[model samples]
Target: MPEAIHIRPDAARPIDVAVGILMRPDGDVLLGQRPAGKPYAGYWEFPGGKVEPGEDIFVALQREFVEELGIEVLSGEPWCCVEHVYEHAHVRLYFYICRAWRGEPQSLEGQAFAWQGAFGVSPLLPATIPLLEWLDRVRYAQPS
Candidate 1:
């Protein structure tokens, strides 16, 4: 017989993550593949990381971008937030639209990355799927 496992209630609490959607002037956005040895490794998603305790989301965004992609975020604004539960953990993703940044993005973490006008990559992270749909709606919506 297989052994049963237990999960603590606090373990189900959603983790806060700051997600940076680095948008170029031409409407392209940046994405990066998850590095090997991380959760969701090899899956593509927007560049960002966990929000440290008491840390501002924007600060977290800038730090993560620099650490992961070597870009310094210059201008950005909060866009939206979503919560999702994965086998790994429950995450509350705070999405941001970064309009300005300094330096060209370099993959500092040995992961592949690209600027995409249309996200054509396969094996997108599950948490990012709905965010993509929302992006499409915003990008293609008729202006008032």
Candidate 2:
């Protein structure tokens, strides 16, 4: 007999999010602190937000960058996608590597943001930690 599949009665739908990692020429990347009154408040994360219905992921990424950082994304590409479940919601995050943008990143949402090479921030968001680890590993890899 086949094993029965057990599904949670209250399984939440995964919300699509577009995340932007702005990388400078010197290998530094941007990190932002979640503002008060939001989920995971004070936890550091990459800049991004939920993708609205019918919106293109790239369009969502550009919109989020401009809204959250006050910068115009000049060049970027999709890097990877990952799904995470938090106490509040399940999220499907689409990450993009933003290499060029216009204007300096500013905290427009009452959040703290910084360009970090060594990531000294405390309490990083759960989903962000793995990405940072992956980034470190990639940056440390020997060139073939």
Candidate 3:
């Protein structure tokens, strides 16, 4: 057997860009709050995590669903990408519109999760608010 060598982080902290699944069912979608003791604690946002090297964005989203949320991403399409500059580091978010899936949703990360209608959830984190607005179709895919 060969050992799987781990690659170091881009920065001392890490540089992670990931996908957030807007899992839609019956015309609504699910949102999860970042757990306490974490970077974006108490902020309601889509469920996802860090992207690994050599990994494609879509595959990362599917894997994240299985690992972090204990669900399967039946299908999704590329939605939008967002870049946020936090004090600690920068993150580029790739969001997708989950078109289909099965099984009940669970928060494997032990964070709070919610299902809200398009444009329903609010008071979310500044980073994710734009995504919510996109789900709401508040504006076109890109700002005019």
The digit string of per-residue lDDT tens for model 2 on 76-132 reads 677789999888888999988878799998888899988899999989999998888
Residue-wise C-alpha lDDT for candidate 1, range 8-105, written one tens digit per residue? 75467799999998887677889899989998899999999999999999999999998988889997778899998888788999998888899999
TM-score of 1: 0.87
* TM-score, one value per model: 0.87, 0.88, 0.77
**Candidate 3 — what's its lDDT?**
0.71
Please give the lDDT score at residue 74 for candidate 2. Answer: 79
Q: Which of the two candidates, 1 or 2, achieves a greater lDDT against the reference?
A: 1
What local distance difference test score does each model get? 0.86, 0.86, 0.71
* Model 3: lDDT of residue 71: 80
| TM-score computed on alpha carbons, candidate 2 | 0.88
Among residues 3 or more apart in sequence or in different chains, the pairs in candidate 3 whose N, CA or C atoms overlap within 3 Å are: none
Give all candidate RMSDs, comma-separated. 4.7, 3.2, 8.7
Distance from true location, Cα of 19 in model 1, Å: 0.3
Give candidate 2's error at residue 125 in angstroms: 0.1
